[model samples]
Target: MDGIQEFNPFSAGGLDQHNDTTIPISDRSSQPAVLQPSQEPTPKASASAAQVELLRQQEELERKAAELERKEQELHSRGVSMGPENNWPPLPRFFPIKPCFYQDFDEEIPVEHQRVCKMMYYLWMYHCVTLFLNILACLAHFTVDAGHGVDFGLAILWFILFSPAAFICWYRPVYKAFKSDSSFNFFFFFFMFSFQVVVYIIQSVGIPSWGNSGWIYAISVIGTNLAVAVFMMVVAGFFTVSAVLSVILLKMVHGKYRNTGASFQKAQQEFSSGVISNKTFQSAAANAASTAAQSAFQRN
Candidate 1:
């Protein structure tokens, strides 16, 4: 009987131990469960995603800046003038003609040639003034003697004709040559201006009934009137200076043109174009042909 004895749950120590275990189970059920290490959220993925987004934004901004810069450059290339207007001299309102035929000369003229062009413009102005003064000098002599009337009249005619002619013949051509970088125009201007410089020298020689107050008049008037002689000397000096400067400028222009490959071929091309475009040349050619035909018919 003792060897086969069964365990009793209702006994004092056993029942109390069972009740303690039951209460622990209820208490464990009431408490929150703690998470394992693998279950905890990591901030690494979110942090990496934010970094990538920031980098993408930065790249987009850079791309936009580059695109804007490219657009600005394209605008500039298309003749849209850049830079501040304050950098250039203000245009003169009183002048009958604009400083340059090119609307953007200030921007377009090369840095090397800017001073040269400016000096040329100044010389043109000075030449015009000198011509005007020459006329005045001739009139002054005319007031002294009736025989000087012819000189005064000639001086007036010269001024009226030569001023505009010179602007068209040399000044504009030189401007166009530099502006268009045309070698032909440069050569043409060089030849034309050389002739003009010779004219200046001739005009400077003040003759008795001629318009100029050059060395000739300066020497002739020295004994009679010291003041007139001094004036003639001054005028001759101006003319001499102009001639020298014109020669120097011509040399400089020629050097530049040669460097740009101004050749005989280019000169021929320019000559051909001029001949083709000249109405007077065409008329003369037609007349010559007609005359030749008439002669042939008569001979037959």
Candidate 2:
């Protein structure tokens, strides 16, 4: 110890020498460090690991339920109700129904009246053309005999009897159909048409007074080529068909009339008490008046 050399650290008396036995913290810092939980690197695996599976299952179940609910909603919205009574869309008023005895077309309709009118009009034209052809064919008989086939008296009688029948059975019913939506007119047309069919059959068979023997299918008729007799029958047959078709058209129009929101309350009233004062009727009339006014306004 006496031989130890003196430190030449610039003869510094600032050197600390108070506790040589105790090592300084910096000199012996290799001891295992006490790690703090807050300072440690976080685990890559989520801490919510246990909850994750639960959440996934919950979400999956929720999605399944939502899908089921969505399917139900879609079916409901697609105009398809699931219940027995709710299985179909609303039916239009123009379903398989009989013709109305009265018609009042002034309101919006699910189906257009114009379309029905066009069908009827076309049929009418077809009937007219057919009638004309038939008449011309029958006239051939008269042409062949000239004076003897259908004399003036016979012609006058035929015209008188048949013309009135045509008007009453066919023309009047058609006229009613055009003027109003009437079930009676429709029935009239059907009835008249049926009668005409019988007449046509009679004439086509050449049953003497009705059908022509000069035109097509002349072999079926009784007359050979007597133009007057043949022509008159053809004419009569055509008109007979016309009468029947007039009834059919009347029925069709009547069907469309129901879709028009037309009410036969007046007719009902007439049938019931010869007058109308029911609330339903009063409101209906008011609505009609309002609708007409609005239409007029829009037109203006």
Candidate 3:
């Protein structure tokens, strides 16, 4: 009866004892402990294996995203362009098969084409400068000759009329020339500007006037003017006729190539204006170019 009383099963006993000396180290490490509910992430691995599995999945997703970005960059390198116009690496080269067939038929220009083109460019620039000067001269005449009030008024009027015209005829055309690839447009502008120079000269030389006819509808001046006016007029005539002849010759020389610049400009505009097909122009051009390159390589 005494032994039975000493061995009470419900009492705290050896099973509940926490003596480190009696416990196996591996078993102690493996055992679950009473944990505090935490607001913070576990620093020293209180994490359950299930939580570790979730972190692995997140890492996999980020890795996949980086891989996809790398693949996109690779595809981009193969002459595939994005955004409008598909403008990518590899532009067209000049003299792509050098007019070999036309060598015999193509007439050598009597004048050096490059020199003529450059001269015409210089002439157009001069015409613009001359037109601008003409405006200034009229303004000078107006200030100087107040007694000839009608002449002053007429000069001011001429300045207003010609300033905008000169901008359109010379400034805009020069901008176009720089943008253009056509050999003809280059020379065409050069010849046509002579006319503008002539007009400028006539206006500069004569008394303030109402019309192109130098003698008709002339303004009266009280002051004696310099002979510099006459020199201006002669210069104007030379330029005007030169410009006129240039236009005529250009029309004759490049009747067929009139649409060359127009086509290129239209294509560029269509891309910018959101009217072009995504893969039509640049993609096709790339494909054709690459095919040509491949063929060239194979032959070699």
Error of 3 at 168 (Å): 6.2
Off by over 4 Å in 3: 1-120, 136-144, 147-300
> Candidates' TM-scores?
0.56, 0.33, 0.31
Using lDDT as the measure, the top candidate is 1
- Tens-place lDDT digits, model 3, residues 85-200: 42112245463432211111113222323333344444545544544544444444445555545654564565566555554564334434434443433444445455555664
* Tens-digit lDDT string for candidate 1 (1-300): 878957788888778878856755555666568865786457998788899999999999999999989989998889565654432124677755434333345776666666666667777777888778777766666666566688779878878988877877887777767776776778778878989989888877666566676778667767766775676677777777777778778787777676666677877887799898899999999999999999999999
What are the runs in model 2 whose C-alpha is more than 4 Å off? 1-111, 118-135, 145-168, 171-180, 211-217, 220-300
Worst lDDT window (10 residues) for model 1?
81-90
Query: What does candidate 2 score on TM?
Result: 0.33
For all predictions, the C-alpha RMSD in Å is 13.3, 20.0, 21.3
C-alpha positional error of residue 31 in candidate 1 after TM-score superposition, expressed in Å:
50
> Which scores greater on lDDT, model 1 or model 2?
1
**TM-score of the candidate numbered 1?**
0.56
Ranking by lDDT: 1, 2, 3
lDDT of each: 0.74, 0.54, 0.48
